[model samples]
Target chain A: MTQSLPSASGTPNPCIELSNVSKSYGLVPALSNLSFAIPEGGRYALLGPNGAGKSTTLKLLIGSLRPDSGRVSILGSPPDSRAAKAEVGYLPEDALPYRMLSVRENLEYIGSLRAVGDLKNRVDYLLDALDLREYERSNVGRLSRGNTQKLAIALAIVHSPKVLLLDEPLNYLDIPTQEKVIAMLESLQGTHLVSTHIMSIAGRLTDSVVMISKGTILWKGAIDELKRMGSPDEPIEKIVARMMTGAI
Target chain B: MLFRVLKFVLRTRFSRPFLGFILLMIFYSIVISRAIPPTGISVIISYYIVGIVAFFLAMSLATGGVMVMKSDRDFLFTLPLSSRDLSIAIFFSQFIAYGVTVLLLFAYLSQAFSSALLLVDLVALALTLTSLGTIAPSMTTKGRVSASVLLALWTSSALLKFPFTPGSAFSGSVVYGTATLVVLAAATVTIAFRNLPHVELDMVKSMVRSSSSEIKAPNSYVGKSPVSAIYFMNLSNMSLAGRFNMAGTARYVSKRVKSTWVAAIASAGAAAYVAFILIAYGAVHFSAAPLPAQIIANVILGFLAFAFSQSAITYERIWLSLTSLPPATYFRNLIAAKVLSLMLILAPFAVADAALAYLGYAGALASMVVVAVVIPGFFVLEVCWAAFTAPIQVKGDDMLMPAQFNLRQMAAAVPLVAVMGIAASASGVLDIALIGGLAIWVVSASLAVSGGFWNSVVSRLTESGFV
Candidate 1:
């Protein structure tokens, strides 16, 4: 129903694209006539209130959910197509990583399934990068919440996914850990679409914001543009709060 | 406030089909009672009613974990509501959900839906609840050891033991059980209030950090090759390690070996006990044996079917893990891992039972073959259908069916069951029947897969919502 970014001026095929997409579970509609496109290698933050379809959007991109109507494409092919799914990585909000599995096992299993090149090196890199080395032998069910989340993030990117969809990725982390995650994400290449209610995380990981309310795009623009619109002194959260509640 | 929570629980947890099943079971119980001549016999009727309810509660608890201990600490712990109020609300919600079902079942069995048997049932349920309360607090902790310890302690308590046996509680001693029940329930309530403020959000979601993990270096076993990282806990089945290239397969085998060892021990014990009875009676002959004996053996084989299939369905966790593997490979590995685990666990017992029994070793060998190969392989197909369609809610305890099933699965299963059930019926000749039955089921299952049913199942699994 709305376009959040400027009209496309470059390549016609964006890395991630959803055209007039809509999906509903039972009587409750999740995404309604949603349309958005992220150019190849774009980094964007998805903002919406709880149940505003941020997770739904990510699921659609990863082929976890088939749109009831409209289309979802990854790298110019259907999201569910083998080629598209192979290139996508997802971190579900709950991040249940086979509770019976140890951290290293989960990493290795997902990495091999992903058929990532040099699978061993990739698992090793993630185990080290995500700070999950210590609990590598412990069952995921035994890990602390922060550790589980780290394992989840690791699993998502274990194959060095071409497109990453992360939802509330910073939830439950200590401040220092949050900083490290942000720094790591900033260094990664490829398209990253982060969904979070935390304004600070949005500001740090992405320069563009795609804001939706009640499952439809409410606004899309540069974060700087959003900050500028709030009169030179207004906090961006205030502007976001108003926009999310339809007070804008 | 408590009622509000109860409403939410009922709305969320009870589905139309689940409620329908409960009603059907109640009606079936009632019809049987009326059809029989037990109306005039109060003792028989009351015992029947009490036994049924107690069995349901125990079975549900053993399988689903202690329902009475359920806590949605997510919202309640953070709310302004007092711990006492929260405790009452949580207790009553579980009470109405499960407790009411017991009452309804008892009432239906007595024909009037309100005979004097209900008071006994209520007392038994209350004792069970309080006993659960005393042990419930400990289950919140993870791992098998803590639970086993608590279960041992609870079983040893006289308060729990008195009422659970069939006729004792309904006799004169129910009052003591009732009083102990009240005291325990009160103590549990006090604990709940004290702990509510201190409770944390169940999600210990410390979203991981980008910082290096606590371990300074990778394990010595791990090298550039991922397979070298293979290791296991004391409970694991490390035997299957060297063969599979799939890391998922390795992970699966390690986890399974823990339960497999336990199953093997239990199966061995049961087999030895049965074998000794057979050796003593001098009736080792299997085929050409009485019909009941064959039925008894096949029932165990049926359990193997239920167990293997239940474990194979991954519920909500396999979506990402299996996303890249080809459909055929995924299904293949899934079946292999599940069947292999069952055979490894049960094969020794199968061999021992067949060898020790007076029945010719050939019959024992044949029965064991059925247990080791036929059931596991066929059940895996049954599992595929169940997981794809209406899979039963897999719990820690065994249900009539491990996962849910729908019309398609039921339709698929009927022929297999009829063929196997009929074939396994022949006295002493069950092994012969089983072999033939296995061939038919395998061929049908293969056709189901080749006919695009397998793909549909896979697609349903990967794209479906949380289990």
Candidate 2:
């Protein structure tokens, strides 16, 4: 559901905001003073190549990782604050559900923990939607990788979180499931940031694009603006490659 | 190419150190064996039986090792090599690892026997056993099952040594010798070649493919659980305790049931063994005082408590998602759940001890107190130490360095040790100390449960790039 509008400040207070946030690991910086905003109900893609701070950025937003410097606020609350977390739903990179738990049990356990409203119904809906109904009773360890990933996704969205941060949300999905998941994501309205390397995923899941390279923000604008940066005949993938490599 | 592979395998830190250590141990054992005078036929027969048993044990371990090797077989198989080449490479590679260990044992036996015939027998036996080891992993697709079966067989054979030996046969006389060696070697080579063709490189690619499937969708859960708030707050400094969401919490509770049941069975089995040992000792020495017996019982119980406590936190490593929750909430839940589980495991023994005490059995009351009070105290102490010291990481599988050998961990362990020690010493009044100590621990733990500690840990984790 779309979030209610904030008080009139003309400066639309974003549900999620990063101001000059930088994070470094030893000698290598993963995120370099990168700043961006996802307004309440705004769907944005944090597009980048491998090691472009996409996962790192999502981690910061979800309070899984702290910025080395600068501020990260989720819904105007500190990332580590309970209020911020309560409003957020995060699907980590390579989301791993408890292996020993059955698919149904995994859903029930996480659903109950999230204090999900009508948890059984929610879990059932996810199972049906993800086509995990057949494997519902099977242990996650025994289930194929695709099934496990499906369960992980179901766990992430079971509660219907507000400020959602997803990293490469459709990595292992078949083409049909990908379309279904894309459709499912498109139907949801909230402050969202999806980090992905795929331009097509970015186009399907988000309206605005935030392109980052070597831990720094290279560009931030509408998807149309990103497309406009390329020649009329150019594929968006080539344009993104040029931007990422600093050739354009 | 073969030399390069051999050099790489030999040069590994584990390989080099392992080889050196085995050689040193062999030299020491041989020197010790030589100092003792042999008792002729009986000694020779004993040595022969021991050698055979050792060979079997080595074979079982090698089989398990082959399974470990097979788990990573796809990586080696992908190097543009033929199946025969791969099989030979594996045979040589394993020969280096297991061969070094077997050779050390052989060298030790050679010193004792001092016969060229005995030395030849030992070397041939080790090589045959080592070859037989490769058969299990080569035949089975499931490494864990094969390894477990081999381990069980090895353990049973070791345990049943008396029944297997031919009482009158001398060491040099051959019964079923050369034929056994030939069969073992032939089987090993046959299995290796049979399985080599089926070793698929796609295993590695499939493994990777399966792992990378789940990607989080943006804006999925916007409003959900209150616990998610706690999970988010402590996300960076993901404590093991904090990871407990509803599903995790349920699993945590269920785990307690499984662990407690296992512990109860183990405790019962141990109690029976200890009874047997005590009975055997009493039979041998009828005049021994009850005080010495009590002391021995206390020491064994003390060791059991400490060992059990040490592993309690480590066991929870599998349920790492609980780290996503807040530390305070998670720790409290975990400690409470574990305490309940510990009580369940210890309850039967506590009852048995109490019954014995009622019947005026020697030191029964004290034993009961040790089992009930000191054991649970140790459990609490371990949980606390694990919570404060070994904070969980988000990735779950992050290799935890010994939490920088800080004064806090040492200081925490001291009181835990001291309390358990005192309880063991006090005996019947152990319950009072357990209750008092737990209250004190809970209060002390509260003081260290600030958000600052968690924040600093989270920041350190973030810096380390683990989250």
The model with the greatest DockQ is 2
DockQ of every candidate structure:
0.15, 0.18
Error of 1 at B293 (Å): 4.8
Instruction: Give chain A TM for each model in order.
Output: 0.93, 0.94
Instruction: Report, for every candidate in turn, its global Cα lDDT versus the true structure.
Output: 0.56, 0.56
lDDT of 2 by residue, B35-70 (tens): 756534345445555544443544343322331223
List candidate 1 segments past 4 Å from native.
A1-12, A26-28, A117-120, A213-218, A241-248, B1-20, B37-267, B270-274, B283-294, B314-316, B326-328, B349-358, B361-374, B391-464
Provide the TM-score for each candidate, comma-separated. 0.69, 0.68
Candidate 2 residue runs with Cα over 4 Å from true position: A1-8, B8-75, B82-85, B88-133, B138-264, B267-271, B274-324, B335-467
Clash count per candidate? 18, 20
Q: Residue-wise lDDT of candidate 1 within A1-248, one digit each (tens)?
A: 11123337744467888899998876899999999988877889999999898878887777656788998988887766677777778887757775555788777666655656776777788888878777887756567889888888888877777788888888877888888788888888889899999888899999999998788999988999999878888989999998888787
Candidate 1 lDDT over residue span B308-410, tens digit each: 4544554326446444544555555545555555565556655655654444533444455555556655666666655666443221111122112233433
Best model per lDDT: 1
The lDDT, on a scale of 0 to 1, for candidate 1 is 0.56
Report lDDT (Cα) of residue A118, candidate 1: 70
Candidate 2 per-residue lDDT, tens place, A1-248, comes to 23435659776678888999999877889998899877788889888878888877876776756787999988788776666656677776667675434677667666655567887788889999999998877746467667767887787777687877788889888899888888888777677788888888989899898888888899999999889999999999999999888998
lDDT of 2 at A89: 73
